[model samples]
Target: MSTTETHHALWVAYGASGVVGTIRKSDEGYTVTMAGADAAAGTYPTMEIAKGALHSHMTPGSDWPQFREH
Candidate 1:
């Protein structure tokens, strides 16, 4: 059998540069800001898609460094 873990994340698209802001739940829906700006409050159907959208808006070199360093 497989076990599933539930996570909640929020993502924001900041302007033309395509920068992304990500916020997520840590332990039991406790608010946790991952490694970016605080995104506007919203809900996504799945955590994977939400994370994918946040990654898609990365500004190449700059965003990668921030993501890696954190």
Candidate 2:
């Protein structure tokens, strides 16, 4: 018997006013575009961070920890 697996790719971006952006790959690399801005492109090893950035951007009203210790 044989088995197969599948993986998906994703793209993410954050804008000046906490605008979130995302794109999914049809084959490999992902694409992104911001509000009335030129499209920027890139690739990633995985989709975790890409998704995270989208969430972070959408929830700008929330508080984030600031690091003081080194």
Candidate 3:
């Protein structure tokens, strides 16, 4: 079960870098935002699914490609 309780915008970013993705709740359901677009990613029936959709976009891990330090 899910609650209608509203939530502030949820975002995932890396350090000073910009956001990788976001999750928002609406009357319909939770929405995923990425690449600077709305509903660009996917919609979820539950906040948990929406959160899982964020994946590494919010989490910091080696999944992202490695680059040499400047």
The best candidate in terms of TM-score: 3
Higher-lDDT candidate among 2 and 3? 3
Candidate 2 residue pairs that clash: none
Candidate 3 segments whose C-alpha is farther than 4 A from its true place: 1-18, 56-70
Q: Model 3: per-residue lDDT, tens digit, 1-70?
A: 8878664454442233544566666676767666465445777888777766665454466243221111
Q: Which residue pairs show collisions in model 3?
A: none
TM-score of 2: 0.33
lDDT of 2 by residue, 1-70 (tens): 9986655544444444543456565455443333344554343334554344334544467443221111
- Could you give candidate 1's per-residue lDDT for residues 1-70 as a string of tens digits? 9998875444433434543455354443323233354643434445555455555545554443122112
Ranking by TM-score: 3, 2, 1
RMSD of 3: 8.9
Segments in model 2 whose C-alpha atoms lie over 4 Å from true places = 1-19, 52-70
lDDT of each: 0.43, 0.43, 0.56
For model 1, what is the error of residue 67's alpha carbon versus the real structure, in angstroms, after optimal superposition? Answer: 8.5
Worst 10 residues of 3 by lDDT: 61-70
